[model samples]
Target chain A: MLLKDTISAALEGLKRSRMRSMLTTLGIVIGVGSVVLMVSIGASFERFIVDQVESFSGDTFEIHAKGVQDIGKDVLSITFGDLEAIRGLTTVKNIAPAIFLTDRAKYGREEIAPMILGTTKEIFYNWSMKIDEGRLLSDEDDKGAKSVVVLGSQAAEDLFQNENPLGKRITIGARKFTVVGILETMGSPLTAELDSMVYVPFLVAKAIKGRTTYIDYIALQSINGDNELTRQDIVSLLRQRHNIDNPEDDIDKDDFYARSMEQAMEIIETVTMSITLFLGLIASISLLVGGVGIMNIMLVSVTERTKEIGLRKAVGARRRDILIQFLLEAIVLTLIGGIVGVIGAISFGYLISLIASKFLGDLTYALSVQAIILPLVTAVAIGLIFGIYPARKAAALQPIEAMGYE
Target chain B: MPENDAPLIETKNLQKSYFNEELETPVLFNIDLTIKKNEFVAIMGPSGSGKSTLMHILGFLDHHTGGEYLFQGQLAHEMDEDTLSRIRATRVSFVFQAFNLLPRASVEQNVMLPLIYHPTIPESERAERVAKAIETVGLTHRKNNLSNQLSGGEKQRTAIARALVTEPDIIFADEPTGNLDSVSGIQVMSALQELNEAGHTIILVTHEKSTAEHAERIIELFDGRITKDTTEFKTRKAKEEDSLQK
Candidate 1:
């Protein structure tokens, strides 16, 4: 009975001062909204990283020289013979050796300098590169060193705006080659940069370089099993083939190094996780400040309503009744703020997602269920935390003194 | 009626005091008093004479230190605050001097508040009782108005209706007309007189002679002790009864 009376009375009390109540509610709304938005943005960033990693299949590995700083820093590299040997191994399913070189690319009047990559057709499947129009290079093309090339998604756009580059001949580094295909847009800043490169047969690129036998990198995939063992077997076999006596000292002496796609995935997860934690810590402070505001106003309210407290007690309201009224009033106030904050957060997340997609190309603002719920829970807990002092003060007023108060 | 009906309220050598760290100040000295059921008793005193304190103790709104108070033949001085609260809830109600009606509450809400605490009365019956109380106070027309919006007389009437809504045994009004104009004061006193005529016990505390004159019996206090007790105003209720007998 007291709960019903007090709660209704509390609502009435708020209604009596609509402007003040609204102002108080605004504090919590901003606090909770920022927190939810921060959390959702964090989730979206994590999703963005995961999507980036997923584009390069999880079963693939990249082989390159250890501690190579630039294009020409490391002399130790992979040869075509070594690539054939790694393919012959039991654990190896597919291999593609590619050498990266930067040269002036030109088709008709358009000209720009971008990386020129030469590899077999296996790289198209290994890197999940989708061809826009025509077929990729065939095995016979790689063996015969055919002067046919595939354009990167960006390179095709820059070199051939509206015109079809497929079957059209273009000059790539003093050699004339027919464009066979163009890779679809990847949209990642890093992967998109890689997409700007032109792809050709391995022999064609080597012949252009005049007796270039060794390549800078080899990408490979393992048979359907644990890839860690496959990675280890590949490393030990390379050491044996290279005639390295001490394999443990390979970090300093060894010519080559290999990493699976899983290691890169782990790095992305850890970095994003820490970023979320740091941002979340900063956002929680606003909630604390909002709670403090509630506490401050409630204390003032208790003091101001001393006579009312006395009057209610004189007419038969118990301490618990007064306490429940003020406490529930505080809870109701924050709950209103919480609901408004959730809507504000979602709208903000959508707006932010739109803005981000403009520049980053399809980066989402993830508004997960957990992200929405945390701010609401924080709001209630804050109400409960900050509401106790004032309610208790109101409840403990003596009827005689309060009644006599002017 | 027999003359020997037990007193509805009996206080023997009732005393109240306030204490600081080093000294104790007594407010109400030794006093013995009895009020019967359906009595219209007014207590008058100068400032600091403890008339309001006595009324507060009698109305169960305050505690009287070092006293033996018998309320309806039950020893009440030793009762806990909760028990006192229960008595205040059902049997005793107060009307404060400042017209202490909740300013934010409408006249109807103010009147219904006391009944909200009455456990045995269902919620549905409270509205009817509140309406009746407002009618008795002649403020039924102002029931929807907030107390802050009402005139001084209307506010006091709403306070009285709040006192009356629970159907309490005793209505202890502490200077109900103190904050009102002479015209509003008279209207408020007559409302009390009307309630008294309906057989409800009315205990009033005031310093105004005209207000005290409305009661059947008046008691004057000097320095926390009763100096005079009189029945000078019996003619008003008695003459009305005599005319009714005609």
Candidate 2:
């Protein structure tokens, strides 16, 4: 029989039982929709994390006390000595040692807890930090030992009540420091709480707290070319200075740990992407169930249309022709469902991103091609895998017995 | 017609049996028969007498358990399933007692089915043949009507049109008018008779004496064996002329 005639006849069969066909297709729709939406959400979350990581300076790395009990514990053992030794290396462009102290600050009795960070002037350049108002801490300020502070945007708002806070005095654990600059909003970091912090000169902060041989963390930048080599050099130099054989072993010792931002980003990306794909794979179970649904319905359809099969066979339809007709119906049904699910997922992703950005301040919604194509191709494959048995069964039916079936 | 030449349909020592697991019940005994080109014949028997079974074997819808069956000198047993289907499509057509029209199909589409199976006919010419078949069956006014909407005789006529559209060498009618009233039965028999007289060979299986009376020859079967084969004595010339007028 002609292909057009066969297809038209199949369509006629579907039309004759419209409600049944629609119900069968609805199972596929839900199956495809759930899979696509789940993967889209997972992908969006991964993009959110990647965007947060990329917001940091890609060329920088962080150094902290190895074997530190906790990141919040007294890791002040890293001092200017380590920073100077790191700077002596040929591949080291700039190094900044950071000391963090938490204290209550009062501005007209609006008291709030905020972090106070003490670092050199070069930290602004190395870390890509921006100042929204006034000026950043200058090298002259670091050299002359001035008592000046930079307020994070949130801290500035909390203390100054929308007034320009630059040049204003803010008390930090009893010593008053002048607000030399107000830092721009950095939004939320993937791993840090940066909104409620204050920055001050390293020497001044040490003097105010009477601290010696203590530093919180250090930021390092490499000179042009071979960042891996530079990172190795810095690690070796720190290891030698701290008298540690293995940096990993130093995690329990009072040694120092150094790592490039690229390494950290790679680790973070691997973890986040693994999580996304894990969730995507979990959602694929539903897609598999949807495929089985197609198979089940097709089997039922083959049974219900036994008489039709008999008629076609009686009219000289080949087994392959019967097989192809049923297979094509299944594939077409799934592919159409896949398309609808994709469209739904894209629109839903957009809606979610719009809502997220409103609360999260311009976070981008990622549209991954794999997220779209994987589910569609998976749906088609599911149809084929599940459709084969029913097609074969229909094809194998004897013309005499099938015609005799009620 | 000389018996030496190849008949349109021929069977030798044809035997068919049904196995119900315990016993082999033979439905067609060791029978031999020959149908010439364009001869209108009917096989008559009561229910379970093997007339329908013989029609199925003749139409190539079923295989004989032990037999030498030939269509236009080609051995039936040697043909594969695909080849048998091709023969059914191009060389023979069937009209069932229930009219077995695809109920969802329109009258014209039902008539067009057999031509659809004929690979030699161009699609354009198939449409022309379908139109001509429907016209010959006197269903031109109902060409667009679904088979379910057709009356008993109209449905049977549609079946006849479908059988005729392929322009096959023979038409197998297994009680084509079994479900119709006397008037509808007469109308269907007249259509079949006309087709036969127009040089299409027809082999009908019927229990109704009146329906078999319309044919030029009647072969009687009893208990899976042929009992009588004879030419019609009464109304022979009138029936022949009626068949010829079409």
Candidate 3:
């Protein structure tokens, strides 16, 4: 039989049973749609983490005391001397030692719990802090200041409430510090709350809190052309200076728990990507089920058209001809469903990104070639696998018996 | 006629049997028959006399149990399934009592079915042949009607057209007029007679005496055996000879 005529016949057969065809294809649509949607969401989450990582310069690293005491033991402490030792290293550009304490700040009758940081003048530059009002503390302020502070935007709003915060004294944990600046709002970090914080000079905080030797953490900047060597040099020097036992062992094991922003972001991306693919495969089960559904329908179709098969055979249609015709019909049905599902997935992804951008201010979903090609190739492969049995069944039918079937 | 000339069909000891292991029933015993080119022959038998079984074997729709069956002097059993299909498609045609036109197909498409199976013919020529076949069967006016929409006589005529479209060496009719009224039956028989007179070989299986009388030769079957094979002179030839004598 002519190819055109066979295709027309198959199409006419489908047209005669419109409802059944639609119901059969519905399985494929749902299966493909679920896979695409899951993959797109996973990709979007990866992009979100990457953007957050790039917000910080890729070159900076953090330093902390190794093996901080377990719950039953006393906290392992690092000293201000260790920070100075790291800063004095040959490859070091600058270092910012930080002390973090949570305290309740009071303005008349209102009080709020805010994270307060005590650091040197270089904290502003190293941490990307912008002063929106008044001036940041200078080196001289750190040396001679009686009491001075900088409040984050959220802290200022909570404490001063419509009043000028600069020059206003807020009492924190039995100390009064005059606010010199209100820092602009920076977005939240993966680990820290950025909005609710205060900054004060390191010496003043140490004096007021009666803790002069210990600092919580340090951020290190390596000079150009020596970044990786500097990172290694600082880590080794800190390990030696702090008397860290088995320093090489700790470094090999990643048990020190220190990370650059870029590394943290990379870890987040890898984990999210793994989850995405895992969910995608889970959703692909339905796609396989859809393929089975197609096979089932094709088998039923072969049975239903047995007489037609016999007639064609009687009229000299070869087994190969019958096989090709049925296979083509199966492929056509699945490809059509695959295309519909892909369009639906892309459209849904776009709509979700729009809504997320509007509400959360961080929407960047995109469709990848894998998202499109995987489902299409999967559908075609499914067509071939599922089409074989029905095509063979049609080809194998004996002409006389088939013609005699009611 | 020279014996060397190709007969449309020939059979030697063509035996077909059905074995029920439990009942041991045999449907067809040893039988022998031959049909010449351009000769119209009718086989008459009661139900279960194995006439239909013989038709099936001759039509190449079934295999013989134990005998040599030949078409145009080629061994039938030696051909593969594809070759047998080709022969059924291009060399021999069938007209069924049920008017076994595909109910889904239009009259024109039904007539074109045999040609669709003809691999050597191009599509355009097939269409031309279909049109000519339909015109010959006088169904040109109703070519677009579905087979179910056609009358009993018209359905049988469409089957004849389908058989005629391939220009086969022989046409086999299994009770072609069995389902028609007397008027429709006469119409169908005359069509077969006309086709035979035009040098197309036809083999018919019928139980009706009047239907078998239309053929020049009648072969009677009983218990899977050819009990009688007789030829009668054409009535028109007898009348013409009488007029010449007067």
Candidate 4:
């Protein structure tokens, strides 16, 4: 028989039992929908993380002392000497040692607790923070050991509440400090941690802690953004300064580790991709069940149409022709399901991106072409794999026997 | 005359049997028959007389266990499945007692079915051929009606149009009027007789004496064997009978 006629005939058969055909394709619809949904959400999540990571300066590296409290803090601390030695490197653009403390602040009768980040004036150039109200900490403040501070936008709002915080005095633990600047609002995943912090000169914060405070972390900016070379120089200088005698290859023996912003982005991308593929694998089980449903209905169809099959054979349809007709029917059914699923997932993804962008920064959620094509191909393969047995049974029927079947 | 040519169909020592778990029950025994082109022949017998079995073997719908069956001077009984299917598609067609029209399809679509399987028929000519076949059976008015919605006589005429659409060398009708009322039966028989008169070779299987008398020749079977063969000089005209009944 001509392929055109076979296709029309298969369509006619399906149209005869419209409700059953729809119900039979439901499993495939759900399976393909979930797979495409996973891909869309995964791509959107990766883009969100990339946006958050790029919001900060990518040329900077953070070196944190590992196991400082487990080992003695003094033995594992990243100290002032290590920070000054790194600052002397030719590739270093800027460097600062930071100390972090959380304490309550008081201005007249109003009181608020804020995270206190203590670092030098050069720390502004290493991070991408901008001033909203007043000037940042000056080098004179560090040299004079002045009790001066900069307030994050949210901290300023909580402490002063519509009142100008610049030039205002606030008490931090046992010291009084003058607020010199207020940072702009940072809309990010780390907004709670960064946007509520008050910045003070590093030396003053150390004095507040009675001079036992070791540098909590060192932030370094690489000149020309060459993080690889700058990171190698910093790691070797710190290892040598701490007197670790292990070979250069013994990374586990190092007391401090440095991570660049670019490396963190790559790690996030890899983790999100793994989650997408694992969810896709789980979605395929529903596709398997869908295939079984197709086979079962096709079997019922073949039995119910025994007389029709006999008539077709009598009109000169060969075994292969009958096989092709039934297989084409199965494939057409799955292709419809695949198309519906792809459209549903794409619309759903767009809806989610629209709603989620209100809270997170602009998220670019685009479904890749591979995500669409692969699921459609899988749907076709499932049809073929599950369609064979019923097609063969229809093909092997003897005309006389089949016609006489009640 | 055309009588010098080979007969369109022939059988010698034809035999058939049904086997179930090593038990063989013979249905036809030592049957010999010959039919020429443009012959309207009826095989007549009561149920269980094996007349239907003989028609099935002749139509290539079933295989005879023992036979020398020739179609157009070729060994038809020994033909493979592909060859038989090719013959079925182009050289022969059948109309069953059930009408066998696709219930969900229109009469036009039902008649177009055999042409769908015809290997050499150009797609451009299919609709024209289907129209011509439906016109021949006098069913052009109801061509767009679904077969299930038609009366018994209309359905049988649609089946006849399906069989004729292929323009096969031979047409087989198996108890074509068995399910119809007398008026509808005469209408169907008249259609078959008119096709026969138009120089088409037709083989009909029927137990009704009146239905068999519409054919030019009759072969009677008794207990799986041919008991009599006769050529009637004046065959009953189904159109005249249909008018008389009306």
Candidate 5:
């Protein structure tokens, strides 16, 4: 028989019970919809995270004491002496020590507790922190331990409330500090921590807090973007300064850890991809259930149309004709559901992107090529997998018995 | 070679049995029959007499366990499934007692079904043949109505049109008027008589002696055996006046 005739016959049979056919295809629609939804959302989220990770400065590295008992209180693993020693290395282009203290800043009854970062003037250049209004801290500010502060843009906004806080005096724990500058907004994951903090000269903060032994971490920029060599030199120098002998390249035994930002970007990519795969796997279970549903409905259809099958056979239809007819019916069912599901998922993805862009800047939820091809291929394969048994049963029926069946 | 005088259907020592595991219950026993072209024959029997089984075998809808069956001088019993289906598509057709039309299809589509599977029929000629077949059965006025929407006689007439669309050499009809009223049954019997007069061979099966009188020859079956075969009788003419008298 011609393929056109077989397709029309299959469609005619399905049209006989339109409501049953549509209800049978609903399971496939739900299955493909969720699968597409998960895939599109997962892809968009990964892209969003990767874009955030790429925004940070790639030429910088950070070093901190590993497994310290007390993070900021009297730990001798990293000290001011170690910082001087690291600055002595020729590969060290620029470096600054950072100490964090949480304190309330009062400006005429507008009191807010913001994290205060204590570092040198070189930190502004080493970390590539831009200035929005006034000047950053200078060499004189650090060397003379002047009582000066630079407010982050978010911190300035909160403290002054649309007023110019550039040269204004704010009290930090009863000591008056002059705000010399406002740093530009850094939009990244790091923004949550760095954008809301106040900056001060390293020596002034040390003098006020009476910190003599340890700092939290050391931030440095590598010369010529050669972070690997700088990272190795820093690790060795720290091991030697802390007086650890022959640690045999076991980082677990080292007193301090040094890592470049490039390595952190790779770790983030791997973790996000894994999360996407895990979510996609969970969504595919519904597709399996949908396949089983197709099988069940197809079996019922075969039983209900036994007399019809016999009539067609008696009218000169071959066995394979019957098989092809029933199989095409199943494929048509799944193909319709797949198309509806793809449209639904794309609309839902666009809706999610619109909602997400409000909190995250310009997150475009795009449907990847895999999102389109995978669900459709899976739907077709499900039809074939679940369609063959019932079709074979229908084809193998004896015409004499079937025609006379009560 | 085309034999001008050969019988259209010939069956010798035809036997049929139903097997359940290791047990066999015989249904037809050593039946010998020969039917020529353009003959209207009726096989009459009560229930369990295997008349339906004989018609199924002769129509190629079934197989005989032990028989040598031939159609137009070719061994039909030894033919493969594809060959049997090919012959069925081109040279043979059937009408069931239930008037087994596709319930959801229009009368025109129901008549056009057999031509869809004909291997040699050109696509352009299908509509003409379907219209001609429906005209033959006098169903041209109800061509577009769904089969389920038609009366019982109309449905039977549609089945006859479907059988005629292929211009088959022979048509087997089992209990054609079993489901119709007397008036409708007369209409259907008259339609079959018209087809037989137009040189189409028809094999009809019915248990009613009155219905069997409409055929030119009658073969009576008793307990899986042919009890009598007689052709020397006056064929009854089915008329609408008889139905009106009742």
Candidate 6:
């Protein structure tokens, strides 16, 4: 028989049982939909986190002391002398020694817990922070260790409540500090809570901690993304200054780490990829069940159309022709399902992206072309594989025996 | 009728039996028959006389358990399923008692079914043959109507047209008018008779005496065996001999 004839006959058979065909297709739709949605959300999640980290800063490195809480740990702390030494390197654009102190601030009747960071004025160029009003801590404030603070936008609002905080003295742990500047608003990503911080000169913050010798870390910006070269220089200089014997050892072995923004981005990517792969496989199980569902329906179709099969055979349809006709029907059934599933998944992914972007800081969901193509191909394959037994059953029916069936 | 040319269909000691592991029920036993070219014969018997079974065996729709069956002297009993299907497609066609036109297909589509499997004709020629077949059956006005949408007579005629579309040499119509009213019955019988007069050999299986009377010859089956055979219409070979004498 001609391929066109087989297809038309299959179409007629399906049209006679529209409800059953649609129900069988629904299984594949759910299968493909969940897979696409999971992958799209995963890709969008990776993009969101990467974008979030990039928003923090760019082309920078940080030197931090190793954790002493763990066993066999060395308490290698960075010093201000090392920061000054690295600042003169040709690849270094700017450097700032940052120290954090837990402190409470008071303004008239209001009290707010604020994270206080101590750094130089060049810290503004290394981070996203900018002065909205008044002046940042000057070099004079750092040299003299003056009790002056720059309040983060949220912290300023909480302490002063719309009042101009510049030059207002706020007591922090028995020390009165004049607020010299209010930093611009910056919503945090997966990093530091910058909106609720207060900035001070490095010397002043260390003096408040009563540990003027040890600083938390020095933040360094590289000129034209010469970050790796700058990291090598800092490691050599720090190891020499602290007099660690092994120059061949890695920084982590010396209980120190020079971390970059790129490393954090890679960690986020690995995490999202693993999660999406796991979820996508779990979603494919439903398609397997859908294939069996198609087989069951096709078996019933063969039983119901036995008489028609008899008539076709009597009119000279070969067994192969009958098999091809029945097989084409099942394949056509699932192909329709596959197409509908891809459309549903893509549109659903778009909805998820819209909602996530609105509520979750620019998170997006997106369907990849593979997400659509793979499932559609799987649906076709499922039909081809599962359709065989029923098609063979129909083809093997004897014309006289089949005709005798009511 | 007897002729010097080879018979269209011949079966010697044809037998059919239904069997499983426990039992064997014989349906037709040692039936010997021959049908000549352009012969219109009806095999008539009461219910359960194995008339339909004999028709099935003769039509190549069933395999004979014991027989030497031949189609134009080709050994049909030795033919494989593929060869039998090829023969069925080109040399033989059937119009069942139930008017087995595909219920969903229109009259035109039902008529074109045999041609769908007709390999000898070019693809472009099939539609023209189908049109002529439907027009010959006087169903051109209702060609677009579905099979189930037609009356019983129309359905039977459509089946005839479907059988005629490939222009098979032989037509085996198993009770073609069995389900129709008397007027519709005569109409369907006349259609088969018209095809017979056009030099197409037709074999019919029926129990109705009035339906059997339309055939040029009758073969009576009783208890799975032929009891009598008679011819009412004058054999064409006899008329040709008379013409030659003139």
Interface RMSD values for the candidates, listed in order? 1.4, 1.7, 2.0, 0.9, 0.8, 1.1
Highest TM-score: which candidate?
A: 2
Give the alpha carbon lDDT tens digit for every residue of A1-406 in model 2. Answer: 7888667766676677777767766666666777777777766776777677667677787888764446446655576787778778898776777777778887778887887777887777776778888998888877777888888888888899867787778787888888888888877654245657888898777776574776778887888756688878887777777677775734455366677777777878788778777877777777777788889988999998887787677767778878878887777777877888788778887898889877766567777787788788888888788889998999988766787788
Chain A vs. true chain A, TM-score per model, equals 0.87, 0.92, 0.88, 0.90, 0.87, 0.84
Candidate 5 RMSD to the correct structure: 4.1
lDDT of 1 at A104: 91
Worst 10 residues of 2 chain A by lDDT: A247-256
lDDT of 6 by residue, A38-140 (tens): 7777888878788887875767677778762332222447666766777777777667787777778899999998878888887776675788999877889
Of the pair 2 and 5, which is ahead by lDDT? 5
Interface RMSD of 5: 0.8
Show where candidate 2 strays beyond 4 Å.
A66-72, A76-79, A188-192, A246-257, B1-5, B20-23, B233-246
* lDDT digits (tens) for residues B1-246 of candidate 4: 123467899999999999999999999999889999989999999999999889888888899989788887777767888888888888889989998878689999989887888888999999999999999888999999999899988899899999989888789999999999999899988888778877789999999888898888899999999999998634446546766899
Candidate 6 CAPRI category? medium
DockQ category of candidate 1: medium
My TM-score estimates for the predictions, one after another, are: 0.89, 0.93, 0.84, 0.90, 0.89, 0.84
Tens digits of per-residue lDDT for model 6 on B165-217? 88888899998988989898888887888888888999989998778877779
lDDT of 4 by residue, A250-336 (tens): 768887877677776778889988888888888878888888999999999999999999998888888888888888878888888
What local lDDT score does residue A41 receive in model 3, on the 0 to 100 scale? Answer: 80
Q: How many residue pairs in model 3 have overlapping backbones? A: 0
DockQ of 6: 0.60
lDDT string for model 5 (B190-246, tens) is 888888878889899999988888898999998899999988544443344456568
Stretches off by above 4 angstroms in model 3 are A65-85, A88-94, A107-110, A120-153, A156-171, A177-192, A201-214, A221-255, B1-5, B18-26, B99-105, B108-117, B146-148, B182-200, B231-246
lDDT of 6 at A395: 93
lDDT of 3 by residue, A135-178 (tens): 88778778885578888888888898899988888898888888
Candidate 5: give the clashing pairs: none
